[model samples]
Target: MGSVTTKKHQNGLDYVEVSTDLCQARIFLQGAQIDQFTPTGKAPLLWVSAADDYQVGNGIRGGIPVCWPWFGMSGNGGFPQHGFARTRLWSLDSINMHDEIVDLIFSLKLTEQDRQYWPHDTEVKVLFTLSDTLSVSIVNKNNANYPVSLTQALHTYLPINDIHQLSATGFDGSKYIEFGEGPYQQPNDKVNFDKETDRVYTDLSPVQHLHTPTGIIEVSRENSQSAVLWNPWIEKSTRLSRFKADDYLTMVCLEAANVLDDKVTLSPGETHTLTTHIRWV
Candidate 1:
């Protein structure tokens, strides 16, 4: 079994690239927690952003970045937006390679620094495995002797040439809370975004599909209840320096998430796992 290690280059830049026989995938990582995602291979299939190169235009945030106790600004979470998982560095515990596949496990131990945001003693492990298919597993171990509530998501930004011509299936009959003044409740299944939108959908099956003009993207999840679909669209895109207003036509954020609105509880010493597997045809 071998592991992924880092070496600094003479350019004074430290970047992490996947070294694997699985040429279909590449895990581009950075020491800076807030740095946007980069794709070297199959990842580029996940997203190609016209706005910024570092930001993952449309691929799942490839590793398990915990979204503890809350999903966005919804009050249930006491920390800042989207939790603290993204802005922190995770320690690579081990890496194992077998045949043509590479598996890397990353762990983050809750410390006083994490307690400052939310008081909880937790051990989070993220396993990234690449083979013919790309998969991620998030394991949460609660060290406390009581129950803990958390909300989370695997935020995937999927690549697209034209968002207008694509449609998402699997959420059709599910319920969703619109993130706007209306805050309307609606069914899932097939959604077409005509205006600015942000909302969390509750009640999901194990699988969802994204159909584009080129091909179809199938997303399968385990122990996840929500799916998020996002595109900056027109007006919102104009406001973003990273994204041009019309650039929204090329990318979309399709996330498999468990929002605070629908919380998951784990008893003391209990462990919970969240998983998602992606494939396209």
Candidate 2:
């Protein structure tokens, strides 16, 4: 069984670090994000930018940022980008350790500050399972009388030895839409990174393999209809805050999401969960 402890970080934020015989990980109360995951005999599967701002109320540049209720530009005037869940602080609900796995649960609910963005009652809980591999499950519980329609994503940043050496299989023949364009059918048998790449692939398979110079990474998920792949290359990277101009050379994002026509609608008292599993092969 693994062990969990709460401690104030050097950056002035509180986080939970878990260590077991199989692996080690760090999860922050902010966004309930898992910033680090390193298996015993393997390299890290998750990554955070060295230029990231650790200040509270500021979004961390990497790891897993839970984009909820809405994703990207909310398309609603005056609403925060990627919703308010990632920047707000979350509460650690519980920590349960069992043989071969460690579970950490966190919850975030509406507060006085949240009224400006979402006045309705809603709760978000994220559960992280750590073992030789990593698994994340996010649950949205709606308490309002009416149903809400929204898109969400488990924005994951994967570490790589070099972005140029990266390739992803399983996207061939899948339909995708670039960040600003309309839907287009994929023509490539495999996906690779060259310049800035941002596309949303729909109707995905359950498993995907990311090939990197250091190793091969396997990403699998349940209840996911969309997979968003992004790598803000040189130009965009320079304009990004809390990110180095060249940081994109070392990381890639393959997110499990429900976006576009696949948005989720939850009625009052309803709950929806999205889960993803990742490992280095």
* Best candidate according to lDDT: 2
Reference-based lDDT, each prediction? 0.62, 0.87
* Global Cα RMSD, each model: 4.4, 1.3
lDDT for residue 183 in candidate 2, whole number 0-100: 85
Please write out the lDDT profile of model 1 over residues 92-150, one tens digit for every residue. 66767788577777776666777777787777777776665667777788888888888
Candidate 1 at 16: error in angstroms? 3.3
Regions of candidate 2 where Cα sits further than 4 Å from its true position: none
Q: Candidate 1: worst 10 consecutive residues by lDDT? A: 31-40
Instruction: Candidate 2: give the clashing pairs.
Output: none
Clashing pairs in 1: 58-157, 58-158, 59-157, 60-156, 171-188, 171-189, 172-188, 172-189
- The residue-by-residue lDDT of candidate 2 on 145-221, one tens digit each, is 99977788999999987998899887866788896796888877588888999998887777889999888999987
Best by TM-score: 2
